[model samples]
Target chain A: MTAAIELNAVEKRFGNVGIIRDLNLSVAQGERHAIIGPNGAGKSTTFNLISGHIRPSSGEVRLNGDVISGLGPFEINRRGLSRSFQVTNVFSRMSVWENVRCAVLWATGHRYAFWKNVDSLPEVRERTSQILDDIHLTHRRDVPAGLLTYAEQRELEIGITIAGGANVVLLDEPTAGMSHAETDRAVALIRRLTEGKTLVIVEHDMSVVFGLADRISVLVYGHIIASGTPEEIRRDPKVKEAYLGEEAH
Target chain B: MNATTTSASNISGKSAGDSLRFYGVWLVGIATLILLPMIFSSGGSLTSFSLIGIAIVFALSYNILLGQTGLLSFGHAVHYGLGGFAACHVMNAVVSHGWPVPLPFIPLFGGLGGLAFAMIIGWVMTKRAGTVFSMISLGIAELVASSSLILRSVFGGESGISTDRTALPKMFGWTFGPQIQVYYLIAFWLVISAIAMYALTRTPLGRISNAVRDNPERVQFIGYDPHVVRYIAFCFAGFFAGVAGGLAAINFEIANAAYLGAIQSGLVLFSTFIGGVAFFFGPILGAILVTYLQLGLTSVTGVWQLYFGIIFIGIVMLSPGGIAGLIMMHRPLARAGTLQTVIPSYVVAAVPTLALACGVILTIESIARTHSGQSSPINLFGVAFTPASPMTWASAAILIVVGFFVARLSWRRVADAWDRAATIARDRGYLA
Candidate 1:
């Protein structure tokens, strides 16, 4: 099977400061990998690079053995790589169901259906309803997404990113503002979503990361400090040292 | 369970039902177009209704970009003028050189002219949006408007170019000889243009235009470039604007620099702004209202311009949502089941606003109107105060104050109603 995503010696520079430098990582088919770092450690930049939102100064972003380093984000997404934003990104004016429904319609090539009704499309609605069910947003499906609480909005944002039926999904800071119960709900949803997909996440919350991620990668100051299983990540003295050091500061 | 949305469902039907309702709207529009000549040929008042139709389509084109996609272009006349000029050139060539080109085929050239203009201008304007984009568009409009006067060789100086459509190909061998026949021709084009534009809103590209308008970054993150989406919407809007221009050329049988002037741009802006940019129908409402004001105000007084400026300012302030937006304001109220409660005050507010508007109109007319031909003095009722009369002035002041207070009081109620609805929504399980 083709590697879902491969980043080789990826380096990103903003003026003179490197955001992501000399990073090499690969998410194999069905691997759920988590990138954990403090604020401004290039955890998000790594995902941005992988998602093609930012171009690498020198590196290769390969998807299924095809170089996609400098391709536009949508082009990368169209090639089966999709990602959620750090903050929630959804059609605020549209209801929760309409938001998901639009994603489904676009994906199913019902985008240009001027004469046909979108809600009448059984296949698209079915997929949308299923996704809503999985995300536990089915109850609020008819509610305007703008009216959604902080936690619910965050959930809907990830839900839209994953709604495109992509095999590889990148979720950034999914549980950022979530409460304990909300975090548990999000973690369970993420676990369910990542079951058959190549999932990579940039998360600040360690417990949620440890709960959902099969493998963990520690990123410090734009470099991958350690890459291993969850237990190995917890046991790494360097990882502990970085977290403790940041805490102390 | 939302009141207005549910009522709107009755008009537009539910999700799938909307398709049928849309089809029905098109059918009625086309039927009206088909019957327009029959109804208009016997007429005085009816003959001018088609002009309103053409302006509606034109205004709608402006709104497609300005209101829907949030890109304001002052140079929209490029497409409009190009459409008219292309049609004129086509007709002139067919007449002068005896080319076998049909009259119906001329608008294709107009459409092509619109597309070409869009391709050129869109490439530049779509690169930047908002203030920079608006400035560039204004510069372009000014440049084009000025060029029409300078490039008199092709633009035909001030006299313009006119062609008699007498020998033009007949629709089923029935010559379009009468002015009313021309009105029907314009109406047919308007209906087609409106339907096509309305259907366009349902297209993916059109929906994406809204997405880009709301947040370009999110659109880019989704995988498509915002510039590309904007370019496509601009090109389509330009195309429609050109179509409206072609219809105008057919209606008047003349194409001139005035059609391409900065005033032309301003009039379209006035129409679109007043109509409300929120709905597809907003521009149409604005256009009709503006056109009526133009015809009515110009006849009533010499100071029509001052009134237009004031109205434009009022629209910008009080009608920020536009006329269509004002109409749609019923949605939340109806949804909250409070529309009935608030209905009385709306009529009350409208009374003072209307009285104030009439008071202003009358004051201008009293000064500007020459009854049998008066010398240097003007009088209103029994008192004399020149064109700036004190009695007239006092009435104007009274009107303004009353109108202002009435509008303020009614507006406050509308705000209160919105807050109440929002509070209720939050209390219910609907909010979060």
Candidate 2:
């Protein structure tokens, strides 16, 4: 079967500095994968490249074996790839329900419709409320997204990312600022929502990485030094020296 | 499946109530429009009402960009003026060719005219959203305004092109020759346009426009190109502006260079912003007040435009949300029945506020009269005073000094009362 995402020798540079060099990564369909590395390892850059937020300097990026290197972010989104930012990014002025509904609109093929009332669409409304319920934000549906608690905002961020029903999900540092309890709840939510879909998460928390990811990739200095199961990754000497060893302290 | 069915039923039940309230508001609005003429039958009032009707459409169109889509346009009058010119030409052509088109259908042609130009201009203009977009709109407004003077055949030069409204085919045995008939015609179009525009805010495109306004980058990740959304909104704004322009043509029977000038653009912007861009009906209130002020002030004072500038600045600095925002801020107190707590303080504040306003007006008027070298006695609030007299200057100075200090003290009391009411509202769960 074709890989869900394939970055073939993807190289990215800013001026003369190489941020990502010869990065060849493959994520299989329906697998939960984790990418862990030191700070400035270009994990976020990899997500940007695959999501078409930025173009690779020399190599192509693919979604489900189809090259989408030069496409715009919206075009890439329509092709079944969705992502959440490290910083909580949302439609701050819109209500929580509206933020989710915005994501659901395009996925349900309600593109550029001006004649139909959004509330009158039973499917869109149902799907939106369902996602809000999943994120446990149904009670706060009427509150503006900006007013939500930080942890709640992070949940809202993940909710919007997956609300489009994209098959390929990329979440960057979803629980970065979350408390331990919030992180656990978020991990459970992510696991439930992304079931049977391809998920590639960039995480700093070792517990979340080992507990959630089916397989792991270790990135350092813009290159992956190890790719294996959680046990194998834990045992890998190269990964330990480059990343896991520092976390051990 | 069971959850979906129950939730769907709940939505339907809730929407039934929402739709009732929605239709009720529209019905009240329509009834008021029908009764306004009965209450105010004077020809001058009818003319003023008709002008207010046209301004309502124009200002609301402006809000579609500034309020909904967060696109600040400086050249919206181009569409309005172009639409007026198109309506005038179509009216003259219908008469010359003996076409059977009536006056009621003329605005639709004007809408099409505005839409066509928007399609051409907005294609390039909507690519950028912020300062770049504003600069381009300003440039385009200048281009159109200057071109209107040079394009004599189409624009009619300085004299403008005029047509007779009575020349159109009669509808319902009304020639639209009388001011009341024209007022009714305008009122009819205003209701239709307002309803159409309001309905648009509930649509998918409308919600997405709001999303784009809040965060354009986030919109991109949700499968929408912000540029496309802005372009569509720009076109709709242009179309409604043109409809207002068409109604103006029918009312005045003329289209002129002044119609497309910077002042026309600024006035629509002023009305929309001052009315409050945050609420749907903000521009309606704005259009009515601005239109009344424009007409009433012009007759009462030579420096009427100066008052408009001051009012605009005051709204921006004191309450960025405008009139609608100010009214909505009191909603929680009203719902909690604590509004009376703030009322006495408001009354106290009003006295000094009125004095301050009178003082500012007196000073400006005196200076204006002196600058113009006019020695005639100035009549203000039923009192006549010479502009050159030291007594006039001293009274103005006294009002300014006393009003400034008193108003400051009174406003502090008002703010304290507001806090008390707001706390009560919060306890009652009326405020968040």
Candidate 3:
């Protein structure tokens, strides 16, 4: 069977600088994959490549069997792919409910429904609330996303990412600034919400990665040096020497 | 699924109430429109109200692009002018060629004309957002406005094309010849377009456009193309602007080169922005206030545009949301029952502010009189004073100095009171 997400020799360059070079990654269906690396390892660039936010300089990115390299971000999203930005990118002006409802509205095929009141849509509103509950942001439903605390905003971002019910979810540093307790809750929420869906997460926390990821990929300098099961990656001498050794964690 | 449906029913019931409130507002608005002419039946006031109606439509249309889609268009007047010209041609056709069209329906043709212009240019214009889009629109506005002068056949050269609005088939035995009839017609279209635009804001497309405004990349990730959303919004904005233009055509019975001028475009932008783009009724308030000021100030002062500049600057600096925002800022205080606490502070601030404003106005007027070599006695708000008098200069200087200090002190008191009220409001959960 075709991999859920496949990046074959994907090369991304900005000006004369190569951000992601000759990278190959395959995430199996329903797999929990983590891309862990130091700052500027092109992990987020890889997410952009797969999500079609930016076109790769060369090679192909495929969701299932179809190439999604040249598609626009929305088109890719429409094809069962969704992503969250590293920075909490929720709609600040809109209420949290409105933000989640927007995603659910589009996903439920309410693209240009001008005649009907969107808030009255049964399916869209229900799914939106459910996601709000899933993210534990139900209490702050009426509050504008911008006014939410950073942690709550990050949670809302995840809620929006999954609200559309896309089978493939890309989360960039979901627990980047979370306290130890918040990170644990976030990992649990991610695992719970992304159940039965393919998750490709870019994270810095090794403990969270080891706890959540079924498979781990170590990327450095625009290249993936290792991709293996958590045990395989932990035992690999190359990963320890190249990255894990540099950081005590 | 069962639980979801139950909650859905609950929401539907709630929304049913919302719809009632929505229609109730429209009813009250239309009722006020019907009663307004009865209360202010003077021909000049009717004409002013009609102008306000047209401006309400125009400013709302501008809001769709600037406020909703965050596309600051500088050339929106192209569509408005084109639509007006088209409506004029239609009216002329009705009269000169006996085309047999009703005058009330001319705005639809105007809308079509506007939509056509938008369709032709929207794809290119909507490609870029923010500054570049604004610049391109400005360039297009300049291009079309200048061309209106060259293409005298359509734009009627400098004087513009004119037609008799009464030439059209009578509606319900009423020829739209009377100012009141035209006023009612504009009021009718204003209600319809306003409702339509407001309904659009509740639509999925409208929500996405708002999302596109706040965070475009986020909009894309959520499976909506920002460009497409912006383009659709631009087209809708153009269509409504055209409707306003059509009303103008029928109201004035003419479409001139000035209709498509940069000044016209700038006027719409100013009125819409001054109204506050964030709120739906902001533009309506803006159009009314701006039109009133335009008519009221021009009659009183030669430097009315200067006053407009000052008001616009004040709105930008003090209340960025404009008049609507200023009104909204009071909501928390009102809700927390602390409005009375702030009223005295406002009075305190207003006194000095009024004094400073008067002093400045006097200084400016005197300086202008002296510069123009016209030392004739100037009417200072009903009192005549010779600009050459030493006492007038001395009083003006004293007022400025005293007003400055007093205004600063009073404004500080107002700010302190506002902060206290806001704190209470926040504690009461009346503020966001």
Fnat of each prediction, in sequence = 0.23, 0.64, 0.63
lDDT of 1 by residue, B372-400 (tens): 34434443344454445566667777877
Candidate 2, residues B252-357: lDDT per residue as tens digits?
9999988888999999999999998878888999999999999999987788999999999999999888888788788779989999999999999999988888
Q: Evaluate model 1: give its TM-score.
A: 0.88
Which consecutive 10 residues in model 3 chain A have the weakest lDDT in total? A112-121
Tens digits of per-residue lDDT for model 2 on A55-133? Answer: 9999888889899998999999999999999999998877788889989999999989998988889999899989999
| Segments of candidate 1 deviating more than 4 angstroms | A109-122, A139-143, A244-249, B1-47, B96-105, B150-153, B332-337, B355-386, B401-432
Q: In model 3, where do residues sit more than 4 Å from their true spots?
A: B1-23, B373-377
lDDT of 2 at B227: 95
**Interface RMSD over true interface Cα atoms for each candidate:** 4.8, 6.6, 6.6
Q: Highest lDDT among the candidates is held by which one?
A: 2
Deviation (Å) of A24 in candidate 1: 2.2
TM-score of 2: 0.96
lDDT tens readout by residue for model 3, B105-194? 999888888989999999998997989999999999999998999998989888999988887888899898899999999999999999
Q: Which residue runs does candidate 2 get wrong by more than 4 Å?
A: B1-19, B376-380
- The superposed Cα distance between candidate 1 and the true structure at residue B127, in angstroms, equals 3.0
Q: TM-score of each model's B chain?
A: 0.84, 0.95, 0.94
